[model samples]
Target: MTETSPRPLRVLAAMSGGVDSAVAAARAAEAGHDVTGVHLALSANPQSFRTGARGCCTVEDSRDARRAADVIGIPFYVWDLAERFREDVVEDFVAEYEAGRTPNPCLRCNEKIKFAALLDKALALGFDAVCTGHYAKVVTLPDGSRELHRASDTAKDQSYVLGVLDERQLAHAMFPLGDTLTTKDEIRAEAERRGLAVAKKPDSHDICFIADGDTQGFLAARLGRAEGDIVDEAGNRLGGHDGAYGFTIGQRKGLRIGHPAPDGKPRYVLDISPVDNTVTVGPAEALDVTALTAIRPRWCGRAPEGPGTYTAQLRAHGGETEVTAALEGDELRVAFTEPVRGVAPGQAIVLYDGTRVVGSATIATTTRRDRTTAPTA
Candidate 1:
């Protein structure tokens, strides 16, 4: 349904116990929807996940959500989806890294946990829509189909991470905070006016599961220490690393190489192969890629019938780059208008037609402009 429609809807607000979420739920309720606040318990062992201002899905978060619901005069409940979250988001994260790829767990969480599992349950329980605090818009066309778009506030737009949502999910999704052009400070001010206790709660950052914000440490604990060699582009060993999974494409620091490069330039991580446990480093120029092959494309609406010029966002906070993309037998082949650096396999490649989200896919392989293969030896 259109956001402007006066008809009351049964909206399931997925409150994360943060200021934005609380404000979103309040706005949905104020809009005359039958809103019920629900906080997802993502971890079975609350202590395993982080707490306080820097983390989410903790016991404190649940209490804060409940308090916000109380202030909003709505019913609140906590759903335990720890098993689902672990199997889908957490396990997949480790598996992807083990395969020498970097995965975005937040995108995976929206795809698998929040939209897939939670939305299924919400729909089955007779909810009309599942709402969240994500800064993205759902534009309902006259034809009754929905299109996901970037928020009016470009700085807070979260449509990139939400690119995984398919049409069905988009049809039943609501982002109440999207259309607001106001700054985040205004949202907190609104929250304070509404009497939400989480008005001043700090926004969660980094990988929430990694409580200490130490992703390498967390992966080492899971995959264990497997000492590996860090080599240069020509197959010369530059240094040693505890694990190849600890590095990512385009990473420049903490490589621990003893000697400077021949040109006295800094080296960047160019490749990671879990099979051989090798981290390949090279000059920054070698990292430039012109094309990519992506798999498992999830279209927000219908898949594009032919090659189309679009803008692609490689990382969550990265700027968009122009690209010509085509789909062939489930594989999306994208040619960048200009070479891009820091793109890694398993990262979600989100395509957009201006402000509208077109689709997303997992980057499988990259084609460098030089077409020179890394040294196998």
Candidate 2:
């Protein structure tokens, strides 16, 4: 494996009061870097503590981070980026939903907050690179250009969320957990051996701002009740819903359609239109899409180098399929070898070449294939 750093340098590790980050800071210190642990106060409500694995980014989380920093023998500080997190991540998430899109707030956090905001601050504070416990690898290629790749453990790989980071942000980022053969349990065991406080802390899975995990209720309070018609593709009204903004593409639950399908299968949410206030539901087969268009593409490396074939990953944990990709102005157009399901607009479409992450873009549109397009054998 390539060296994490060429020389001993000052590094800032963003400890999220978790075992992974605690172990990461420990590894960075072991690597002989001048490491300091910093915890981000990202939650708007600072007084609330992580209760029963529900809310993260609480006072408890920050305290745990400081305790771990103490155990790691590093100076610890808390930076209150609550305002920036609210504006960049929380607001953007609500805005995307208001516009009828499924937004990934974790991606936004990595793109605008964790890497951009935190890294910028670290640079001003004289840190060489900002370290985190993200489960993704950064390696220097044969030609010396740095590249980001999936973690050794596919089950825990977080490259999909980290794909939004460009080359510059990645250059100054360190992920010690990415190169490890140690599983999560082993990391926690290391934390226990080291006596870190967050050794058994549960992982934060929900959107940090939405503490209750009721996305529909959370959105309803923000966007208000804008009830609309539920329709099929042919504009036939099937039923009515509380609000179109609350629904998402490829959603099959809580559709509230009274009738059952002729084939005894269930209908799924195929599209959500905020402009017309419509939720379109159809059979499961209607979700298959062959071609997709993405806007505002951001490259992690040199912009694709005249794109030929790239493995396009459609979802965070979704499988990748071979695709024919090309750039069209500032947008990316890709044709999938097979129709993909659950592809929604406003979600990110990350591209990869082998294990190296190429870049990502927000999905703009998708074209479903018709039966007439079938090739004769």
Candidate 3:
């Protein structure tokens, strides 16, 4: 008696026109799966900016994806997801910033637009699973639960942005490049060997919506700039700013203030009060925080029922720190094992268990336990 071979799966590979995604499709085809390449048209303003090889959903990118699909000998199509992308991703990004919270657009895109909406569409069209080039992996456990894990390539690990996915989504997703590859360079080298057009393309950077790194200008254009006061910790006016939306926590440059600290020390923006139209500057130490609160949390799978210690990353590419987390109603309270500097209120706090992503939430506020005043009778 001989062991039976597994049947080939029907896979829909999302082609971003990057070397990684192109190679992902090629790998899927090589694995003997029925692969269909899809390029999602995510932007309505296709001509607003030059469609560089790095950016996604551009005209040139779509063409590159089609060429790759042709080379891989897979059925390819371009789906117009611009409306959904605007609603689920762009709107959420603007709303979060307007509410004085920093939001990760990529996380929102993965949660609301890509894995959920796009995956559903693929399944509806009779695909077994959707695949992408994300530097992460989906594992099936012995007990029949699906788990999300970091890719074999630690340097390109994208588990932070993908921490919001639920178990069902994880079960239906595929990362073809998860186990075999490590670096972008290696992936590109494979693509070149395969004669794929996107092999030499550069990776996209910054927010996809913003053509350049112009968050302040983008916000001002949308919300309208208003004159505001820049003050010190003691409420003494130092200078003026265009608006509170122009600043972010931990920023040092672009402050047009002329004031030097009385002690000849460097001053940092401590707080931004949108209500009072004020930006406060103080010593760098004022930025240290020990605890933070996050709202509207989404776990990679179901989160643990109670408080536990986990590693949390504050920014996209930042270092992870140990923290104790607890759920309070819909909010999460994260007490860091050590003090973290510049824990901005509007950023993301992604939780991880070893190499596996646990969940993520937007920071609502941060408090320094060492600096808090004691309660009095």
What are the models' TM-scores? 0.97, 0.95, 0.94
Query: Model 1, range 1-377, lDDT digits (tens) per residue?
Result: 44555588999999988898899899999999999999999988877778876427888888898999999999999999999999999999999998999999999999999999999999999999998999999998878888999999989999999999999999889999899999988998999999988888999988878877799999999999999999987899989999998999999999999999998988999999998899999888888888999999999998899999999999999999999999999899999998999999999999999999999999999998674554311
Candidate 2 backbone overlaps, count: 0
Give the worst 10-residue stretch by lDDT in candidate 1: 368-377
Off by over 4 Å in 3: 1-6, 369-377
Could you tell me the TM-score of candidate 2?
Answer: 0.95
Best by lDDT: 1
After best superposition, candidate 2 residue 21: deviation in angstroms? Answer: 0.9
| Residue-by-residue lDDT tens digits, candidate 3, 235-314 | 99899988787877767788788967888877787887778878888777778787999987987777779999999998
TM-score: model 3 vs. ground truth: 0.94
Off by over 4 Å in 1: 371-377
Candidate 2 regions with alpha-carbon error over 4 angstroms: 1-3, 47-50, 53-55, 372-377
